[model samples]
Target: MLFYRAALPLSRKTLTFVAGIIRRHRASIGSCWRKLNPGQQALLVLAHLRKGETLAELAAGFGVGVTTAWRYVNETVALLAARAPKLRRAVRDAKKAGYAYVVVDGTLIPIDRVAADRPFYSGKHKKHGMNLQVIASPGGDILWVSGALPGSVHDKKAEWIWGVLAELEAAGLVTLADKGYLGSTYAKIPYRGKNKPESQKQANKAHAKLRAPAERANAQLKNWRILRKLRCCPWRAGQLAKAIHVLQIREA
Candidate 1:
């Protein structure tokens, strides 16, 4: 089973990081006898998350039953997410760093449409998925990620629901967002008025230039292919997103 990891192409840094996390996870949980060591289990879960491998394939490759493989992956995801920072803390950090502003944006993560519920249907993207709000520094470092919301929720609504705007407001941290978050007092959004003056259009363009890094940050999150199209339970979307977020921070 360990040989399977060698066969699959992965970077040395990622392999080492996964092994370290697995070692720490095992140490925290105390001694336990299992078919695969912590490193192998970590590799198995990382392959599933980073490679988007299915349970059946992971089970065969890791020499574990499908049920065990699923448990291992979910448990590891939860573990990583537990260490993710809350929105308020992230906002405070930004203020302490003397950042003039942070960027906020909402991204849609495609998921398996297991049901016909309209909530998962995003009219904007015309797809079934969940919305995740992300905040990043001007340099494209992700500062925080909000929990999953129904795809049908508007970007502004999602920001309010996640208390992102409120936190920034309380921390006196300005934020740069797109027109999607038009009404936020703490966020500097592009002018959306119709028939705007040349000055307004120019401001919008400059606003766009500043907000470009947020879009790049969102793209970086989606680079974790498991987030490309989630096939697991929708309730776990937040956990998976947070796990990927923490891993990306480590990469930085």
Candidate 2:
């Protein structure tokens, strides 16, 4: 007879860790319990998110309609937002562990044509969808993410960068960004200048002198293919932000 290995049960150490987290923020998940079978809903939502499955794909996978899948995603997003403090705490812990410098940038995600009516802009090639701005630590862990903005909006004006600066300033941390955010007074050291190659190079060098760590961090974020390709829609932009944050935390 062939023998198969059985998976081990969750250890007490892991269970206790999760229990403690839940105990501290039980209220966040309370709404979820009243709305759906929290455990099943959470597992289904996380599975689809982790797989990067589109709404249609999720619908087909779970034998549900696309609208149902969308509803699930929306609810899950709300639940997560309710617990955003936990996410912020995770970022803070990572920063406390020697990850100080931060990188700020924006990317666009493509959406379906139906969503085009909402808000977007036409670029050289494809229609730009939503813009996702992120603030990540030098180690690439996302500290906080802002909601999506219309593609036509300037990167500097995106809520992720400008709207959150006051909170970050209160925390006493410097943020770094590209020329788009040049005029931002909140950045401890803003890097901006004319478009001339020599001028750009000089500005970069000056920025490095002020904060070399943040410059290095931005270089790493741009290395990601998704960031290189601006094609995410407003809805997917939220998922992408969560996905990136989860990945960063795991990698950190």
Best by lDDT: 1
Decoy 2 TM-score against native: 0.58
- Per-residue lDDT, model 1, residue 102, is 91
Runs with alpha carbons beyond 4 Å of true place in candidate 2: 1-43, 63-68, 86-100, 114-119, 122-126, 159-162, 188-236, 239-252
lDDT by residue (164-206, candidate 1, tens digit) is: 8888888877788888887777788888769999999999898
TM-score of each: 0.91, 0.58
Q: For candidate 1, give the lDDT of residue 66.
A: 96
lDDT against the true structure, per candidate, is 0.84, 0.53
Show pairs that collide, candidate 2: 108-232, 109-231, 109-232, 109-233, 110-231, 110-232, 110-233
Instruction: Find the number of clashing residue pairs for candidate 2.
Output: 7
